[model samples]
Target: MIKVIIFDLDNTLYNEKEYVISGFKAVALFLAREKSLDYCTVYSSLLESFVINERGKNFNYLCNKLNIDKSIIRRLVDVYREHYPEISLKEDIEMFLLELSRKYKLCLLTNGWLLPQKMKVESLRLDRYFDTIYYSQQDGLDLAKPHPKYFMKILQFYKIEASEALMIGDDPVADIQGAKDLNIPYFQISNELDDNEKQKIMQFLHNNI
Candidate 1:
């Protein structure tokens, strides 16, 4: 039986692309003011880079394309990370959490930079739903998901065995693999869940939890 439910933050409860877009808008505005460039163009370039899976190099891509100083890349990153993201959970997700919180212990396990993750939790008001929220970066990136230690930490905190917890997340590697390594049961879902997927998750809970 599942006594605790562990959730990944990005692309699980809410769409991670929304957060990326929101951060891009914030950085674009900041860059536009500092470099006298058009905000639309800057934002578009950032989005395009992201769409192409630029990964950690979006700022560099934008700077090289726009002839902006490379020295400012760090500042742009800071702006993106520090910005208060304009994001919200979907109504269905909100209701799902409300319902789940009433029944089982809910915990959030996410891997990301500390401040941005904290902002996301604050923005979504995840505190209302989750009994505990673990940011893996607090323990260092090496301790992030796919490493069994953080997962073990969560289990230890709740004083529950791995078999008693359910991991839900979008990433096949970080979230699912981590749970798998510890023999924790998991339900894989997409970043954005449609009606059918939501129903399937509910069915899984009913049958398993």
Candidate 2:
């Protein structure tokens, strides 16, 4: 039985589309006003650079290299924090979580800056739902997800075996594969995969996982 279910925050818990629309609009507006750069160019280039670097939402590094003022990124992040609380939860998530809480402990294991994620939790009123929340930055740990140490740390901290836990999220490689690496089973919750890829993932999850 899965005693604990570890969840990812952004794009996993809430609707990814809402975050994209709000986050992009804020970034574009901030760039146009402060940097005098083309709104589209800055937004496009920032996303491209972020994808290339594989550092999702780590804007401090991007700010230092882009010659753009860190203030702009910080400002947008603040806007996101303010607006993100208004973001609605996905279908059945609220009810599903309520149902799950009665059976098993719910824990959140996410990697992000302190303010935005904290604001998100507050805005969504998620504190009452989870037994615990483990944030990479807030905890003063560099152990982000996809790193085996991150999963190991949670397991050790909770005093639960890998088999007793289930990691659920939308990201396949990061959350699914990462959990698998540490003998913790995972379930994919989004429909972002093609049929073939989905089948492969299905087998991977059950076979020796």
Candidate 3:
């Protein structure tokens, strides 16, 4: 019997697009304030340099690409920390996560850094529910998600059989298929996917579940 459910943080537990928009606006606002650039221009350049360059997960690359001056990145990170504490369970999530916790040994398996994720979780007070939160950076860059090793580490660390646990998350390539490859039950949360995208998530969940 499945006894554990591991949830991915960020969009998986909330409306994901809103989080992206807010983060973008935060970065854009900071850039505009410090560099005297228009919000749109800074947001655009940010998209190109970070997303297009596929450095979305790399903060150092973002620091360089944004021309972040001394202490700017730290300050902006602090800004994120300030705003993040206010972002809590979206829509049905708080209840859902709570309900799941009652029936299962629920954990959080996320693919982000410590500061931002920590602030968000702390602010949400979700620590009261989930038994554990495995931050990927705790294992270093090479062990991050989509690499297979990371997911396996979590499963082994918890002494969970792949068949005895479920992975619920947002990312398509990372959370979905990574857990799938390990023969675990996988569910994609359709927090912000469009109709077509929702169908894709449904299909994956339907097939896997």
Candidate 4:
């Protein structure tokens, strides 16, 4: 039976795109105030760059476009990473988590820079739902997702075998593969948990646990 439910933070619990857009807005506002640039223009440029390249150098694109010093790119990155993200969980999520928390030991295992990940967790107030939270970077990037170290750590902490835990996440390679490598049962989920997705998860739980 499944006694532990491990969740990925970025795309599993909340919409990660919302966090990205929120970070971009924060950086854009900072640039506007510091460089006296147009806020909308800067925001649009950042969004366009992100859309085109996904996770490419968005700040570099903005710096090149605005003829700003490349040295300031570091500051822009810091602004984006350290910004208090304006993000929210889906309307159904609070109830879902509340319900799950009663039945299973909910833990969060997310891979990202420590500061930004912690900020995201704080913004979403995930501590209320999760019994334990593991930031992969806290251990080291080398032991991040797809390595299975953190997954093993979570299991060890809960004093449960891998079979007693279920890994729920969006990333096929990072989240799913990590759990797989650890011989843990896992459920692949979408970035947004719609009604159908929620039903599917419930069915998976019914079948597995």
Candidate 5:
């Protein structure tokens, strides 16, 4: 029986792109005021850099593209990552979590910087729903999901067998593969679910999980 439900924190629980867009807007405004750049241009350029390079490289990419000094990259990246994002759990997902928590031990396993991920949890007011939470940066370097040790750590800490846990996440490689590596069954969330799909999943949880 699945006694514990482990969730991925980013796109799984809440839309992570909301956090990215919030950061981009903040950075755009900051550059426009502090550096005398055009707000629209700065915002659009940052968005493009984000899309092209994804996360870590965006700052350098933007700076290089705009001929901005390398020194500014750190500040921009810090602003992006450290900003308090406006995010929340969808009402339906919130209800699902509430219902699930009543029956199963709910925990979160995520891979990211500590403060930012924690801030996301706080912003969504989701801290109360989770029995335990783990972050990659909480321990040592490179101890994130996709690593078997990370999955094993959670199981060991909770004293639950792989078969007794169900992992639900959006990432195929990180969440699904990590769970599979340890022989734990998993559910992949690809997109937003409608009411009927939610009901079907709930039925599956009730009947089989």
Candidate 6:
């Protein structure tokens, strides 16, 4: 009797790697232009830096490696965070969401900064499909996933019991364990978006609901 479906937006609905690559390209282009370096070289450097350094400190690593002024790192960081990303759901996902919306109330729950997450939803036109959306930063409760209260707030809002809701997501801790903490059902998958995964979800809904 799953009446509601909660989706983790980033790696669940769409491939988060795509968003990261888009941001990298933006940063690469900016660096190439400013430093008179080849765009491809800058892009490769940024990618390598991303893998080795903490995400927030990637710009510092890039600046140190490229001998670029540290002052400009702030601007680069802003570009990486604020750049408009090219993102969209796959055809299978679009159709699945359309079908799911008809049968179950769908809510998007994600952890991230408020504005950027909203922008991602807007860019992909996902805002229309969800009944309600929750962002960790915007919820005013400072609640983050893996915390029971985070899921509790949503249940309270919809007036639904934990047994009546299902969470589908890619993160074990943030999405799956959080729901499990309350005896809610959940399905976890690898953070890649693929037709096989979408089909599995559709099948799960059919069998379980």
| lDDT, each prediction | 0.91, 0.68, 0.69, 0.89, 0.83, 0.83
What TM-score, computed on C-alpha atoms, does each candidate reach?
0.93, 0.64, 0.65, 0.95, 0.85, 0.86
Candidate 5 off by > 4 Å = 51-57, 64-67, 192-197
User: Tens-digit lDDT track for model 2 on 140-182?
Assistant: 5456667777778778877989998888777777688889898
Question: Cα-based RMSD of the predictions, in order?
Answer: 1.6, 6.4, 5.8, 1.3, 2.5, 2.4
Worst 10 residues of 3 by lDDT: 192-201
Alpha carbon lDDT at 1, candidate 6? 77
For candidate 5, the C-alpha RMSD (Å) to the true structure equals 2.5
Index of the highest-TM-score prediction = 4
The weakest ten consecutive residues by lDDT in model 1 span 190-199
- Single out the weakest 10-residue window by summed lDDT for candidate 6: 135-144
Ranked by TM-score, top first: 4, 1, 6, 5, 3, 2
What digit string (tens of lDDT, one per residue) describes model 3 on residues 60-150?
A: 5555766655466676656554556445565455655666677678888777667777776786787978998778867786777766876
80-189: candidate 4 lDDT, tens digit per residue: 88999999887799889998898889999999999999999999999889999999999788988989788988888989999999999999999999999988988888
Q: Say which candidate scores most in lDDT.
A: 1
True lDDT of residue 134, candidate 4: 93
Give the lDDT of residue 33 in candidate 1: 93
Model 2 misplacement above 4 A: 24-78, 81-84, 139-142, 191-209
* Tens-digit lDDT string for candidate 6 (107-178): 999887777788898888886689988887665545788777768888999899998888988998889999
* Backbone clashes in model 3: 0
| Clashing pairs in model 1, backbone N/Cα/C closer than 3 A | none
In Å, residue 1's CA in model 5 sits off its true spot by: 1.7
